[model samples]
Target: MTDLKRVDIYDTTLRDGAQSEDVQFSVEDKLRICRKLDALGVDYIEGGWPGANPKDDAFFARARKELNLSHSRLSAFGSTRRAAARVEEDVVVRGLLSAEVGVITIFGKSWDLHVTQALGISLAQNLELIHDTIRYLKKRVDRVFYDAEHFFDGFAANPDYARQTLEAARDAGADALILCDTNGGSLPSQVGAAVAGLRDLNAVLGIHTHNDSELAVANALAAVEAGCAHVQGTLNGLGERCGNANLISVLPNLILKMGRETSVGEERLPKLSALSRFVNELANRPTQKNQPFVGSSAFAHKGGIHVSAVLKDSRTYEHIRPEQVGNKQRVLVSDQSGRSNLLYKFSELGIELDPKDPRIQTLLEEVKSLELHGYQFDGAEGSLELRARRALGQVPTYFERRGFRVIDERRIREDEDDDRFMGAEGTVKILIGGVMEHIVAEGAGPVDALHNALTLVLSRHYPSLGEIELADYKVRILMGSGSMSGGADAIVRVLIEWNDGERRWGTVGVSDHIIAASYDAMVEALEYKLFLDKVRPV
Candidate 1:
């Protein structure tokens, strides 16, 4: 085997990723992500465009004092001086300098269409801009990277002018010449061919791609195979339009698949999944379950035969061990699960049972029946564990529910142009240790009211029940074969996530009435908490 080529990982999530729709990073958000990127061992972290906005300006101002990065060098991104402007006096150039960063990446128009139509400048004038901007920045910063914006389209439009543009940057002491698929319309073949054509250049070559064609990662790999040494992308593929290349996906493919080395060495690779979720949490976005390598479902196995084989040898279905990237193997239990699936899931939940135990078969059949009725246990392992323990006669009854009532009220305000206000209240009666406890509470919705009432009654006996906060609530309506014709009485499935400071678990319930389903899920979540704590029935 040949020695792996070392590639530089340049992250632009703070700048380009923040441009995604509904994504706006505060100065604090940018600073927090910078520290994460540094710990992940990325070669460079591209801070946002200084002076472009108040948030970015504040971030750079604060970063100079606060960010004591150990591995990554911070970079400031901007564009060339405007047409008919002096490089020294240009406001954008000055903004880049005021950032006080070691590296500066500046993009210039490479497409003839943009130069003539967008900027309305002569071809010779465009070349001069690329040369002068790069030269001026190189003299000031430790390194200057020239991003050839729309280079693929530019090359297809006028190859001679495109080469002249790159030559201008190369001759002006630019450290790296990055080819950008700005429009994200180029095929992998086109990107590889373009990079292969530029192999004769003296400066280091780089690849920056977008996902308009859903080929951002593919195009990046293509460029690397064609001799590019630097790869630029966002962390979760977050950016404008379809988004930029996903470094999370690209990094694993480079190291594990292509045998390439990156600054994210073997030791840091295990933290990849946490880093991916950290960004998603800060962005207030749910992690994409199917995202390659670092996603929750990246290594999850569901099929019965697939699970049966993977139990013996994970290589039968898994491409790489999930632990290599900090993800774990998950065996999902559904209607299609076999004996092996149940055994695997039981072991995962720490429920030990012999392979010949008849209760295992009974639990499997019960799971199949429940799944047929719309109770999905794959995402609600806490509920599944409770069911398994109950079947084994290990779980004791904690409390008996006497009854509950929920009342929803709506009022129309006449002076407010018929605005309707809604409120809900719930009353719960439970028998705990032969003592009847009655509780009442009001909440924004029926489920919330019931949860409040139930917890108020239970917390007196089990104080930790009050500490289990509801982290997430998801409701899915099952239609077609299960319910009434018009969907009025369709079966609703409620999945509730609960967290108690350290651990989180999910429980599922299904019923025709939404309130009933929510109650079942809430009760199960509390029961699971008690089960984990080994709380004895009072």
Candidate 2:
């Protein structure tokens, strides 16, 4: 096979990814994400719709002034024109110009359904929208991309008209014509054939696939093989509906499978998982554990046969090295786990456990018993490792919880004095290396008071702990019926931020009770931070 050619990677995470329901990035968030993307070495960065919203407009305006992008050229996105307006006088066109980006991307209807129904325009007029917009933008910028919206479905419906739409953009001087799976239902074979049909066009062709069919990555790869020169997607596949093609999956597959050279920096590929999690945290969205390439469970294995084979040689069951994508291989201990799995887990935790040792069997039985009680070791490495340390008598806790309580009350006073009420009071007891400490606090609610009292007690002993704060808190109620008898079970996830004049990382905790879960996560967060500080002193 010939060497795979290099293709441009256009990241739309900031623009299209934000279109995912309830996903919004503040200006500071956008700046931080864009800087990370720039460092990742994507060929182009689509900021957002400058004319559509004030936040996006302000982002582009500010990004242009403050960001010093190294490898990527920022692209501003918008539609062509209103059905009746001239391209030169179009509001969207003006908005694109105001963004002051070196590249401008405009979308036009390739699907006759969208043109006739969505835009209420004739097919010929839609062609004009494509041509005129491309022509106008070509004069202003060196890179003008025309997104052929719903190209695959349109081509299947009316091949002649769909080809004509792309011809119009090519004739109008579009640098690259992107075939978008706007509704994202195209098959991989269909994508390959469609791009091949447009191979003779003068303009460079690209593929912009969505994940509605869960085949965006496959479709993109098929398009590349069939002659597309660029791939447009979002990091971690963030976009409307399912999402755009995942550059996280695509980049590695491109380099490793197709032998294509990516613009992404060599070092940055290893940071892909970290970057994906960081963005998900900022968006306040739950991370997909099974997400391809970068998910926590992507490289995780548990079956006895699979674990044994993987231990002998990772290539026995693994397709790619975990570290290649900045993900670590996880060996999960469950009912199906075997001796090999337990041995591997012990090695990972730096624990020495000989298979022949009777204690090994005892420890495995203990783990299995714990698993029966809803203790999941697969997702709680730190907690499991701490347990192992205790079993081996190698662990120490600075303090231990002695007691806790919550009080609630209400009071009413005279009209002249006004009414007053004591809503809640909380108390906590702690024994630090056998030294007892007690604290009390009041709050608007029971959970609030409990957390405050706990923090107050811990703060007195560990003064350095004050530097940490809860950056985000989330509560999820599980399997609760409308009736109070059901007794809703809740789980709280908190992100703790610790600044020691350096950087920070987030840890997670889960429990049935909301307050207990929050406190559990809060304790883990501080412990993890302190452990890091000690091992890697600044």
Candidate 3:
């Protein structure tokens, strides 16, 4: 703890993260993410490489007017002066200045491989670029950071030259010298030792790591322990190649696990999960359910022994309190669940069932039977609750499905083209209040049509369904046992996520027919929504 200092959280999700495949952020997206990072209390936000593209340039132009940043300084990122260009004549340098940002960050080659092979420049000239780039930007910008790219590799190749490159930046009046594991190949020990070698310099030190080795968080923390005060990362580790260090994971590890102080206040750690999910939603990426601190399953306990122990003392199988990071303890029910797990599941469903209740054992056996048919209850608590209530003979049927029909048509246009187009329609009949209600709808597919028709019929009785929205739909095909001789009759598992503004829940269904599976999951999703509205008050 002696090396502990006030840790600065620097987010590069806008710059480096934009390089990730499928991560395409608009100008508005960048501004929104910057605002979120500010609320999270980060000290710096890399807005992007200002001159690299029209989009980044437009972002900076808008950010100058729109970004009233409170906790973080907006930074424009770019490389050092080119091998042949003067610092005064560099296009990127001009872009950085025109960005009107609070900070300027430029990366220069630290590894000899990059200096000699990549840039094809003499070692002396490369050192000059690092120094001149920082010295020139330091005048216009409030703070200038020198990212020593491939620093560990350089230090490993030639320690003296590596130290000289960093010394050149420090001497040229750089505000901070950030050591970057740019290739992300360095181990934590190597990063620590290399960063420790430069700790005595009279400049703020920082570390930026990528997750190619699956050790970006480790390396970043390792650097922190070695006296570096600033760490650069992205939310949910979004970046090129593998990804950057995940601040969502790193901040919790530092503040909660290692007792280190960071700008992300302990009181604000609860927002971590929301922040992570929001970023994922904006990036058009599904949230990783198993991500360390902020994912849905981060604190989910599924094992029987684990649940029993957690019921006694949550610390038994848990590392830290789930609520500490805006997450919750999930007691997942499945064929593997024990009595303690069953009790926890009942509690979640607002049902009271004794652990010794004979119905509990019978329900457990039923879950096992259902799982044998490819039903996985771990993520489908809504469906699990429906099954549990039916086993106890307490299920109050809200609607009885009398009949359903689906029609799919594919047509080949005559004069237009050879493209094939499809249309689907569904008809549903349900008995509610002892009266038959029939509805019809059309959609892009059979499942969508079925869902539309059911909603048309159900919302009349349960108008709260208007608040429900389909957040996600996942389908996994069950192989082996259930599949036909050539995998024709494979059972499909459908997991549907529904959010009702206030909360989100998942429902699961399994059937040999994909449409049937989807319909079952959709039914349970709506039922769970109503159950919550009736039992859990706003």
Candidate 4:
């Protein structure tokens, strides 16, 4: 850090991140994410564009009343008032001033093409909008950041005009001028050249990039390395098209990789993993398990040699300690896994096994055989534990499912002849504690019916079943092989995700029938719960 400069971290998850396809956030969601971002030690939060939409407007209103962000400054973002409109007369500019936030951010077109074509304005007039808008807002707000939209592309096309646009912002008393790769098509070298070209500008410089080219993070770092003072991004890189740069990866890359300082301290770095998951949870999107720093598999080791090396010296396989980011190292067993992988996995689960034991080899071979068929132990730890118990000659079959049936029906409604509805019913009979119990349930579909009936029967013995929920369900047709025709008997793979409010695990099932596949997955899901509570925990 001695040679590195401190960079400001500005977050736009509530604003830019929401631009992603299928992403919608309510006022409460915005406020909650703002609080979390503040807690994560971000320097500036682009809360939203105040006048652009209803949700942004409501968020600013609520935040002005309820948000007391300790570390991050809440910023209201919008365009540079509008083309040719008076700063005082423009409704968008007026709305931004009324937001009662300390900082305001407005993006202005830097590309001559956009200025002349997109806005239908002369290039000369666009500079006035960039300058006058910032100058007007700077008078009312504590700080104003000018986003030089498409700065790199503009610079590449016309470097002189691009520099002139930023010069106008610098002369307008703008606190920071952010260079945006709006199209997400710029390379890291282009970003470096662009940032370097603006080195003489008086305003503090910032970098905002999109991931369309898969180089947003790299380009941001390149700009920072070239002397940009700030970085703008969204959590998990959520945004339009590909997405903006991921702040979760950017912070660490700045602090740990580039040796630069950021508002996010080493102490709060551990919260990065949780922060990533939190934003995805709020967005109702599944976290990418393979995402670089914070994903579930970020620190996971499955190969035997890798697991063995990690056990002896974690640095051999892991670049950074998982605990440094609040993520734990995981050892998973798979068909490709060696004995060392199983040993470490078993040890973690409190199962002692000798590496040289013949049963160890047998267990490994059995796992490989099962994986060849359809079982995936890596995602289903509970199911793996059950197999381990069986190999150890321990049996705790609390209930025996005698049989189950699922019937799906489609019929035309009498009241609405044009409308048709598909309904499913399921009946399950099980021998629990030596008593036969029968249960029936109806659902919107076959899988739902099976889940409903099975959970109902299990709830009688395991009250915790009420707390368990299906977080996600995925079906992948094996080899483009699953047939859609009735009685086609095509093999399909089903992956069911279950969570008990605290922990989550994945279970897999493969069968010719979709309901039967779902049933297999569901039973394994419940059996995992029973094994954890009744066997290992005990």
Candidate 5:
């Protein structure tokens, strides 16, 4: 195999990603992301367009003092000097300089349609804008990159004019001329052909694309194959409209698939999933489970045949070792599961069962029957483990639950404007070692009350229960009121996530009553914790 070619990774998650709807990063958020990107070996971190907003302005001001990036060079994104404005006098250019960064990237009109209709500037004058902005900044900054905005579209509309735009930047000393698929409608072939056409230019080339057509990564890879060395994208593809090309997917494809080297080499590649999740956490966005390379389900196996083959050899089903990108292969248990799935899950729980054990088939039938009644073990592994262990008589009953009572009350105020009061209380009775413990507690809701009441009774019996805390709770109506069941008889499934500071697990319960379902899941959560710690009856 030939030596891998080198490609630079430019991350715009702080800037372009922040433009995503519902994503608003504070100055601190940007600073934290900058440090993470640098740690991940990104070559360039675009620190938003200074002077565009107070947030961006504050970010640069603070980054100068707090952000001490070791590997990545910070670049300020801005546009060229206004249509006829002097490069020395343009506020945007001055903003770029004030950022106190060694590298600067400024965009310019490449599409004649944009020059005429958007900027209302002459074609020749637009070229002058690209040239003058880069030329003036080049003399001041250590490196200046020119983003030829809408380059591909412009090239198709008027090939000569588009070439001139890039020529203007190249002659003006722009270190890298990046082709921007601003509309994100360009196909991979068009992007590859356009970048190929620019091969004659004596300038380094890069590719920046959006995900409007869901082809941003494809177009970027095509351009790389055609000789572009710089790739620009946002983490998790966070950006306006559809989003930008996802660097999470782009980096692995470039290195593992295309055999190209990147600033984020294989050594730092394992941090990709952590970095992806970190950005999503700060962005207040849920992680995309289906995102390639770094998603939860990216390497998950569900089919029995697939899991069976994967157990013998991962390559039978997986395209790449999930560990390459910091992900793990998961075997899901469901109605579609075979003995292979059960064996894998059992082994994961540290349980051993012979393949010929008749109990294995019985357990499989039980799981399928429960799933038919709305028990999904895929996301509730704690519950699945408990059930499997019970079949083997490995789990011991620590306490006997006698009963529980939940009371919810609402008092309407005489004055319509006055707020009504809603309260819930719960009573739990348990028998431990021939002693009965009854406890009552009040909470904001029925589930909370039941949890408080149950834990109050168990704390005296098992002090370890004090360490466990509820992390998350979700409810799903498996059979809705609109189904054949009617409004009064909807079956609901409740999932409760618990954490004892060291580990986390989820338990699930299904019932026609929401409160009953919550109680069932809550009890299982406590039982799983007891089982995990190997606690015995007091």
Candidate 6:
């Protein structure tokens, strides 16, 4: 039997991770995320550099009192003292010591290039900075980890000197020696070889990688297989450049693929994607659709053959089950979809549509025809359900729009003496449910006016339906057609969101015309809420 050892996962999402470009989290945000990470069962949480910035300092000071982290030991991170100062006298060291945390992590220059260029110090002085700092911190805390910044490149350049630095930290009683890919350009093969070389060292070995080369997770795993017992990373891969290793991706791979156990609870694996999106939303950054196990499209299927095969056995198309990492399989509807795909989707939604039913065939043909005209229902579940209900003659009683018009005008007054100039008024008309709910609203643009007019009419009947917010909107123009075609065919997809009392869910719509696409998605968003109300009877 292969002896599976347990590994420690240290999360630095609040420190090195917050350095990600444009990722600035307030102290309150940091505390909230830390609490979530603690509940998720990470072994260690590196709060921040308390001495470097007020925000980080405030987080550590406040988090210690308010947040009760049960499974995680809150760690304070910083650099070793300057070459000339003693460890106890340095401001950085003093700040860490004052934080009253049980664990402290300090980084020092291991690469000769950083010593020569960045620090302007001799290699011996740099070694002293690492050794003396660790020795001093050991006196104050039970655990002290030394992050060897740029260790791999340093080893490649000066094997003897780099090994000497690790020896110094080990001798000084540093608990762990973490090899950092500070530049994020190291390959997996190189990482494996380097960790293998350090296997015989007395100290515990760890890895800290970045994603500049898009290989942070791969490199960290390679280090683990090569014998490193600990992994350091940030939640959702947040970090300085590119990002730090994604603990979200790394944890499951360790547990499921490598047979290694972690302090993290098994149930928390499924919440990874939701937690990732929650952090991204709080940070005001767009989540990547293709991000490894936890992204929305990670297990989504669209092609006919793939979907059919997946229905037979998900392993045919999926590397790992979606539920293993808190995600679900999505069967997308597109021009490439087959009858089996539609039937499967309908069944999953609990809509009993028999394959032999004439109405089912009609709906299938209508969907395919609409797809050819640039309507994509794959991302629009609510819209597809609404279409299915309408085809089956089961739509709810909705008010009819007899006619509607939108007029957008903008006027600018220059110098008070000259007459104001007026922008052209844009207008649109539509009829809904045989009712004449005529609305003439003005806006800065035509699209705005049209959206306002529709909302004005729909709000009357669905008074409880909250505001429809656009989460994501994408536009793609296909230009391969011949010059004779007046304009390139356009495809617009929009994700609309609605908030109930408890939570919010998004629905999508796609169309050839931009306005129609937005409108279709908006209607679907409202319809989904309506359907949920009936099903759950809220």
**Cα miss at 340, model 4 (Å)?**
21
- In the predicted model 1, the residue pairs found to clash are none
Clashes of 2: 0
Q: Residue 83 CA error for candidate 6 (Å)?
A: 1.1
- Per-residue alpha-carbon lDDT of candidate 1 for residues 292-325, written as tens digits (9 for 90 to 100): 9987688788888998998899899999987777
Predicted candidate 2 versus true structure: per-residue lDDT over 1-538, tens digit per residue: 2223878999999999988888877776677678778878899999999889999998998887778888889999999888778878889899999999889999999989888999998999999888888988999998899999999999999999999999999999988889999999999999999888887775689999999999999999999999888999987788999999999889988887788777884546776876787677667676799987788788788898998888788888879886777776778874333455566656755788667977667777877765443344432345556556556655556677787778877655334454475567888887875678888998766656876786777767666665665433444333333233455543334433323434334444545555566566556665654554453212
lDDT of 6 by residue, 253-325 (tens): 9888888878885767765765786677556566688888988688889898998999789999999988777
Question: Model 5 lDDT vs. the true structure?
Answer: 0.85
- Candidate 5 Cα outliers beyond 4 Å, as residue runs: 1-4, 334-538
User: By summed lDDT, which 10 consecutive residues of candidate 3 come out lowest?
Assistant: 334-343
Q: Model 3 residue 193 lDDT?
A: 86
Worst 10 residues of 5 by lDDT: 333-342
Choose the strongest candidate by TM-score: 2
Give the higher-lDDT candidate: 2 or 5.
Answer: 5
Per-model TM against the reference: 0.65, 0.68, 0.65, 0.65, 0.65, 0.64
Q: What does the lDDT read for residue 421 in candidate 3?
A: 75
Per-residue lDDT of model 3, residues 220-246, tens digit only: 999998888889999999999999999
lDDT of 5 by residue, 1-538 (tens): 1122788888988888899998887665677678779988999999999988888888899889777789999999999999767889999999989899999999999999999999998999998999999989999989998888999999999999999999999999998899999889999999998888888786789999999999999999999998798889999999989999999999889888988988888877777876786676566566788889888788888888998998889999989987788776778773232576567658756898999899999999899778777776644668999999889988898888888899998755456655577769999888988898888998878988999898888978888998888766667776664554556578787877677877667788988888888888888888889999999867
Q: Name the best candidate (by lDDT).
A: 1
Q: Give me the runs in candidate 2 sitting further than 4 Å from their true place.
A: 1-4, 265-267, 334-491, 496-538
Name the lDDT of candidate 2.
Answer: 0.76
Candidate 3: where is the Cα deviation over 4 Å?
1-4, 334-538
Estimate every model's Cα lDDT from 0 to 1: 0.86, 0.76, 0.83, 0.82, 0.85, 0.76
